[model samples]
Target: MAATELKAQARTGVGKGAARALRREGLIPAVIYGDKKPPLPVSISYNEALKRIYAGGFLSHVITLDVDGEKHKVIPRDYQLDPVKDKPLHVDFLRVGAGARINVQVAVHFVGEDKSPGIKRGGVLNIVHHTLELSCPADAIPEQVTVDLAGLDIGDPIHLDAVQLPTGVQLHGHEIDPTVATIVAPSGMRAEEAEAGAAESAAPAGETKE
Candidate 1:
């Protein structure tokens, strides 16, 4: 994962008016909290922040925030967007400590679909969960998890336990392992059934009419 560097200034004012004023000045209002520290209000360049956010995977990527010359390692935790224009309004950053384990949702990527027996047999792939919540070391967070569909057959369900996490990473909670995906009969099967029913209904009916 590439680290993105962002520059910000510490803000003294708070609340709606201050936020609006900051936005009017082409800045974004933000806050950094966590690691037992006080919540720090800050402001950053709107264009720069949007560029990083649009760069993709901003939430999962570790960011290096330069707040008034002091560097902080953080990750974007939450953000609010304008409902009408869909522009970013506020952002919340979570400070990460060295070796600290943080819970984050990691995107799951499916691979080896061409090798799956189910797919070869015209089985449809049904995804149950697109992401998995994981607890990982701050410095070792994985960008995404890969789930292989090789050797999978129709009616085979992939479970959470089948995924392999990197070293220093683990499932976030003790909840029961859930199904990630499964293969089932394709939609064409339903159409085929309907066609079969229609064929049976049409057969030999003409003789009775005569």
Candidate 2:
């Protein structure tokens, strides 16, 4: 994880009104806490926070928060966004150590053609799952995990166990999860084919039907 450098200022105010006033001034109220340190209240600029989180991995990205003259190595653990205005409300920073084991949701990327034999024979590909939970050392966590679907064919559904992960990373999904991505025959197309076959069979033996 790399650290994003942003300036922070110590906050002496508390309560909703104070926070609102801070936001009105283009600042985001935040707090930093960890097992070894007491919670420290701070604030940052709205533009900097948005730039850090807009990429979607800010929670796992380590940042060197420059609060006044002291620098803290922290990660964005949580934050709330304004429903209508889409602005940052409150932010929570967590101090992280290099060797710490952390649980996080990683994006899953499916690559290649639908591998099922059914798909090769014209079955539609249906993906029923997306993100997967994983546990790994904070430093070894990957931005995303890729699943190879080039070999998947119709009637063949990839399972959690089949997914590959980086060394020391473990998936939290169970074998019982119905994470189905199948190569299924299109219902309308199948129905039309069946009807055409019936019409051909019903015509006179020597008669040709277009």
Best by lDDT: 1
Q: Distance (Å) between predicted and true CA of 133, model 1?
A: 0.6
Off by over 4 Å in 2: 114-122, 173-180, 190-210
Q: List model 1 lDDT by residue over 18-68, tens digit each.
A: 999999999989999999999999998888777777776678878899999
Q: In candidate 2, what are the lDDT values of residues 78-180, reduced to their tens digit? A: 9999999887888999877658777777777777764545656777878776666778787777778777777665567777767767899886655454463
Number of backbone clashes in candidate 2: 11
My TM-score estimates for the predictions, one after another, are: 0.87, 0.79
Worst 10 residues of 2 by lDDT: 173-182
Superposition TM-score, candidate 1 onto the true structure: 0.87
